[model samples]
Target: MIDRDTVRHVARLSRLRLSDEEQETMREELSGILEHIEHIQSLDLDDVPITTHVVEVENVLGEDVPHEELSVEEALREAPEVAGGGFSVPRMG
Candidate 1:
């Protein structure tokens, strides 16, 4: 069971400002989630395989092939701003 104190502590750790009603709602919701997890833990699945995903997946990306490299002048031709033979971007604080 999720207690009010636990909920309050979690809210504090997450820097959340919750009203009294919200804290109570969170306690009930968290308790329900824990109950569901407990039910899942009680399931017997000795023959079930451990899998990250439920469905089979295959790589859909195209084959990697080497391509001709672009020249420095060609690369910088479309730049909005260029400096020192490279693209110049705005400075970030």
Candidate 2:
């Protein structure tokens, strides 16, 4: 049973400023959500299988093929700066 105080506490924790009307609405909505969860919990699913997804999925990507490697000059052609036969990127802190 989600109450007004619980909603207000959650709002405070989330750093949200809810009006009185919004708080009341949130309380009702949260209570309804809890009720729905309780209803779902009451269902009998002893034979039901736990699954991560509802539909079966398979990798659709095609096989990888070997490709010719690019030369250092070709790779660094569009780079803003080049040093020591490679792209010179900005240093990170």
TM-scores of the candidates are 0.43, 0.42
lDDT of each: 0.93, 0.89
Per-residue lDDT tens digits for candidate 1, residues 7-79, read 9999999989999999999999999989978877778899988888778898589669987789999999999
Residue 7's lDDT in candidate 1: 95
Candidate 2 C-alpha lDDT tens digits along 6-90:
9999999998999999999999988988887887787899998988877889858966998778987899999999999987888
For every model shown, the clashing-pair count is: 0, 0
Candidate 1: deviation at residue 76, Å? Answer: 28
Best by TM-score: 1
Off by over 4 Å in 1: 40-93
Worst 10 residues of 2 by lDDT: 54-63
lDDT, candidate 2, at 49:
90
